[model samples]
Target chain A: MKKLINGADTVLEESLDGFAAAHADILLLGAERKFVRRRTLKPGKVGLLSGGGSGHEPLHAGFVGRGMLDAACPGQVFTSPTPDQIIEAAEAVDTGAGVLFIVKNYEGDVMNFTMAAEMTGREVASVVTNDDVAVERSTYTTGRRGVAGTLIVEKMVGAAAEIGMPLAALKALGDEINRRTRSMGVALLPCTVPAAGRPNFTLADDEMEMGVGIHGEPGRRRVRLASADAIAEELVGAILKDLAPEPGSEVLLLVNGFGATPLIELYLMVNSAKRILEGAGITAARFLTGSYVTSLDMAGVSITVSVLDGQAKELWDAPVHTAALRWGT
Target chain B: MKKLINGADTVLEESLDGFAAAHADILLLGAERKFVRRRTLKPGKVGLLSGGGSGHEPLHAGFVGRGMLDAACPGQVFTSPTPDQIIEAAEAVDTGAGVLFIVKNYEGDVMNFTMAAEMTGREVASVVTNDDVAVERSTYTTGRRGVAGTLIVEKMVGAAAEIGMPLAALKALGDEINRRTRSMGVALLPCTVPAAGRPNFTLADDEMEMGVGIHGEPGRRRVRLASADAIAEELVGAILKDLAPEPGSEVLLLVNGFGATPLIELYLMVNSAKRILEGAGITAARFLTGSYVTSLDMAGVSITVSVLDGQAKELWDAPVHTAALRWGT
Candidate 1:
């Protein structure tokens, strides 16, 4: 594999080490180096923690800062962080206000975070985000998999936590956000697993895998590659079909790139998505476009739409300062 | 080529349209759609403008907002924007305080920006960043190519401009920044131009290109690929060799990924880079790591080190809000 790594076994540890060093002013490495906590924490404020596999960067760790996650536990590539790592992170960040766990709905992640919350012995509340409308079941997930909408949950709940919201209320707000958001993805190329030393799956040059999971898992279908406009339509169509948002409802549109997809293409996809939304009479109240979540070296795009209520919109618009996503500071 | 674009001819315009739409809060589409301007330009403030090809997303355009470029002109992929587009952007953003043009060192960019400044009929000054310390001469460039170091130039100069610095002073500051910064890049995979409909160049499965230009141009050498630590040593070695900062000097390190390189790899590379810097006894005052500058879908990494003074460091930390780079605001 033409990967920029020292060794497959050392990728996660080295990456986490680099991340902590790069953002020294904003992030601190936890006891085992498997978790990262924000450098500064407000006393007695609710702590927000989130994490998953290693490849989808700028997710849990990148989002660790003032108005986002307080700490994050990154597992090995495409693997869940162990309960011990999560529990350690929870204990480190927990203040008098308690801690909240934001989790993606992968079977391993769900189980691990749940175990960590129980083992921490802190007043911990949890929310499992399962907004991917791609498939009922996938390789690593049971129901729908959590996808890009996790970003929305992190942002909204992070803002609430920043304002000292209680753990129970934060959990409810996160659940509501997860319920209102939906996502769908399409992969133009397969990603190679560093350890496996080959692509996760074989795809013909002219074909694409639609609704692919972040782990390079099988999707709902594979079809001949089409124009970006068509791909946007298919992904957005799938998400909207599952969402059925009211005609004039305001929604936040997130056009995320699976790793290896260029920003130019993401913008083009956004253009196509905006065209479709305009035609459907839905207003995109805001848009976030970039590689917020990604599979390792996968060339694809995921479309996420969060049907927004006034409170959610306010929370989304609130100031956030993180290593990956920052604004309104 | 597996590119997510509608058509080669429409890539620039469509991407610009999407960028403007997605960042409508902070960006406004120029009259010709070849440029983007900040929606909230301070009257009488010094206007900052930069532009180049469309493939480098979030470069010129994504940096348009408060405390950064007042406007950006985008040309076709890997092609410099015409004098007409540059002139239009300068004229649109020019305030009574005058306008400053930041151009890369490419021949096309220099000639075109110079022509635009002459034709704009506004008080204009320019800075051509040529910080790549790779090959002295290469395709599309003369002395050197402006790589990721251009970001440091833009950030420092943008902050100066925000404080209402005059055109001459801003140009001098930019020139100093260019002189103090150095960059070098390596490519593991080549990028495909949408127009060409194929990879710009091919690499053997076991080979890599060092000092590759953003446009997939020939570099200093091609050799067997090595570990991330060795690669980082070579790149950081090249840059530090050109820019021999004293051991106690503070510097800002930027580990930029060419398009398609995952954040995971970039972070790993950053880890390697920090190790090298530490070995050299050089203090990395701060860091900016991401795909700040890209080469379409090319998978590679570039290391940029800016020898920092107190003033430059302060400018780097100033509040500036833009689509691609935002902080402190």
Candidate 2:
């Protein structure tokens, strides 16, 4: 595989080193690389921490800063971090209020984060996200695998936590956000993991894997490539089927890239999906388009639709200062 | 040629529709998609305007908003915008303080922007960027192509314009930034222009084009793929050779992606290049990483190093709110 790394085994540490150096102004590295935490801690504010495999960057790590995650522990590519890593991160970010873990639904991630929640000594709680509607049970997950929708979950709840929400309330808020969100992805090409040195799956030039997961796992089906409008209809249709938001309800639409797709294509997808949502009498009032959650170098796109209430809409618009997502600060 | 676009013919307008919808709070689309202008234009601020082909997104259009370009005109993918479009954009953004055009050094872009400057009624000036150290004379240009370094120029000068720097002084500051910066890119795989419906060039599995242009134009040479560290050395080495910054000088380093390269690889290149800069006794004091300027779906990265004086460094850190870049609000 033609990847830009010194070696597969060292990709995580090297990239972490670069990350730490580049963003030194905003964050700090934990001892032994257990996690990355904000440089400045806020007293009595609940700590918000999340993590998973290293490949889907700007998710857990990039979301760490003023109004988002407080700490993030990154494991090797497509592998879960150990419980010890999560424990250390919790300790580093805790400000006496408590620590809240944002765990994805993958079995390894849920288990490791749960172990850390148990092992840590504090008022700790957790919110496990399973917002990917692509699968009920997948290769590495027991239920729907958390994908791009996890970004929305982290963002809205992180804003509430920043406003001094109690640990229990923050956990509840996170769960509520996750319950209202759904995502589906389509892959034009499989990503090559640094360690694997080969694509995990293959797609013919004229085919696409609909409902694809972030780690190149098998999706719902492989089908002949179609126009952006047809793909947008399928993705939004499945989401609307599951979500069933009332007519005229407002929603936030996210057109996310899976590493190798261009931003223009993501924007084009946004236009197509927004039109589809309008035709269904659902107004896509808010929008974000970019590669926030990504697989290594996969050529694909994920559509995330989140039904928003007054509180969620306000929190979503609140100021956030992270490496990946920033606004009003 | 698997892409998420409805049709190559409508890609420009469709993407612009999505972009305008996604960022309505910050920018306004001009009549018939001629340009995107800041929603609340400053009355007396020296209006900053830039534009070119549409494919290298987040460049001209994404950079439009507060503390940056007051307006950006977008043309069809990989083709220059017409002179009338530029003239109209200039008229919309120009306040009492006049307007300054930031043009990339392309044959079409330069010729068209020059025509607009001559045709406009108000006082006008420009800083034509030609910072690519890849080739002295290359395809589509009479001199070095303005690549990723153009972002640095727009940012630093945009910051100055925000503080109400006059049109003439802003043009001079932009030229100064261009003089101090140099860039080089390496493309692992060629990009397919949607309109062309084919890859612009081809490379063997184990080869890369060094110093490749943003449009997939020929670079200095094609060589066997090398490790990230070795590749970083070659790119940064060429920049250092041409720039020849003082041993103790500080710089702002930008590692930019060519649409498809992953973020981890960009950070790895950052670490590699930072170490090389330190070895040369030069300091890389500021950093930005991502695919700001891109060649639609090309899997590659470019390294841009700009020497920063005290004023330039301070301006780089100033508050600027745009769809793509935001900080310190």
Candidate 3:
């Protein structure tokens, strides 16, 4: 297998060092036993803390900025951040406003973040995002694991907090966003974690896996790679059938490229998405095309749609400042 | 030239179609235009409109939520959105509050957004973000172009607007964010645009490109592929020299991965970055790691740092809600 960098073991540390040096504006609390918030907590604002494994960038840390997360605890690659680190971050970022923990609906992330929240003596509100429509509950696991939908929950809750909305309201908004948002993803090729140094899973040149997770985890099923049109049909069909948003309802269309998918493909998919939405009598009031959230270098795409209403729409239009996302004004 | 999609021509259209169908909540303006606010614009809030090429996903669009932007115009892959499309998006999201255009400092993006902003009339505020520290002004073109620094400006301006800050303040904040921020990027391997069906550039296994642009444009220089440590040193050195934040000052650290780089690599780089910061006696008050802004599947990373003061820090701490970033409360 071909790869860049020196050795897998040193990859994480070296990269983190580089990241810190380059971005001196953000404090880096190294990956140690206790990870502290790089920034001091404001006197009144509630400190919001969220984190998980390292692979999903811009998700945990990238979201850390104004109107968003106060502190993001990053674990090792694909592994949950230890409870100690999360707890420390929670404590560090907590202001009197009370910290709201936004945890993605992943087994490890849920468990770790939950532990951190539980350990915190401060007033803590937590929301678990389970918006991936592709996964179904079978009594064994949670209904649907949070995928790209987590972005919506995080943003809504973050905005609410930034504007000094009550924690309960923020939690409710987060849950509501999750309820309205659904995501389904497909993987064209398995991504090779630098540590693993090989494809996460083997697939024929023409094979693609649907409902894949970010950690190079297996998806629901694998199928022959089909035309972008066909793939769009399947993906959109599943999302539409699952969410069943009312026709004419406004929606946020996110055509997210997994790691390696090219923009050309994403645009093509967006084109197909336009036709399908028109045919279904649905109007896409907002369209987001790009890698808002990604899975390493997975070479695939995921579709996330959030049904918006008056309140949600307002919140969606709120301005935010962060390393990864910003707008408004 | 290994790829998973069926055909190159159909990629963008199909992806968009699937995206629209999945996101019933968002209104897809069809293939001819970009996305707009799903709900009718609030009667008095100035519309915040921004757009560019399609590759930077969730950028101009994902940020179109509350506390951020009003609309985002998406163009073809790596190509700036046409003025017509931007005009339509502006019209669609405008609520008589006027519109603010947050544009990255690229030739195409600047020209296109500039044209669109001019056509929109006097109420429009256009802020161009040119935060890249890598490129130096020569006899040829404008100094450095914008990079990940655009994200920071967007968020800051978005937050100002969300809080009812006047357009003047928003514009000032955008400009300030642009001034305080700087970025530099490197590319290890060339990325492929689906329609092109080939690599945008070529790099030997032992070679890496420095100072790369977002659209797979060639960098300022090329050198032997170095270790993550070495690469980080070079990148950090340039950025630090450019910004020259105080040694003991607090700052924000952003470690951005281009498309193909894995989380493991990002983490590794982050760790390395932390060490570099320590050596400089600088602390990152905020650190973000992820593939927030990407360039297709290009295997590379960029670092951005914003020197923060009390107000900047407070604003950075404000809560926000959007597709890509969430925090606060």
State the fnat of model 3. Answer: 0.44
Model 2 ranges off by over 4 Å: none
lDDT of 2 by residue, B132-155 (tens): 998999999998999888988999
Give the per-residue lDDT digits (tens) of candidate 3, residues B62-153: 56655667677777777788888887787877667778888876677778778877887747888888887776652222667777878777
What TM value does model 1 have? Answer: 0.99
Clashing residue pair totals per candidate (backbone < 3 A): 0, 0, 107
Interface RMSD of 3: 5.4
Q: What TM-score, over all chains together, does every model reach?
A: 0.99, 0.99, 0.66
What is the C-alpha lDDT profile of model 1 across B141-255, one tens digit per residue?
A: 8889988899899999999888878889999999999999999999999999898999999999999999899888888999999999999999999888879899988889999
lDDT of 3 by residue, A1-329 (tens): 33446676755555555544434454455445244243434567767777876666556776666667788877776777888887778767766777888887777778888877788777888888877766675222366777787777777677777778877777777878888888888888777776777777887976888777766566678888777667778877888888898988878777877766755467667776666766887777777666656666778888888898887777766776555566562
lDDT of 3 at A141: 36
User: CA RMSD for every model?
Assistant: 1.1, 1.0, 7.8
Chain A (alone) TM-scores for all candidate structures: 0.98, 0.99, 0.92
Q: Write the per-residue lDDT of candidate 1 for residues A36-86, one digit (tens) a residue.
A: 999999888898999998889878799999888999999988889999999
Give lDDT tens digits, candidate 2, residues A1-329.
Answer: 89888999888888888888899988988998889998998999999999999888777898999888999999989999999999999989888999999999999999999899898877899998888888899999898899998989889988998889999999899999999999999999999998788899999989999999999888899999999999999999999999999999999999999999999999899999999999999988899999999998999999999998899899999999888988878
Q: What are the Cα lDDT values of the candidates? A: 0.90, 0.92, 0.71
True contacts kept of each: 0.76, 0.68, 0.44
Better of 2 and 3 by lDDT: 2
- What DockQ would candidate 3 receive versus the native complex? 0.23
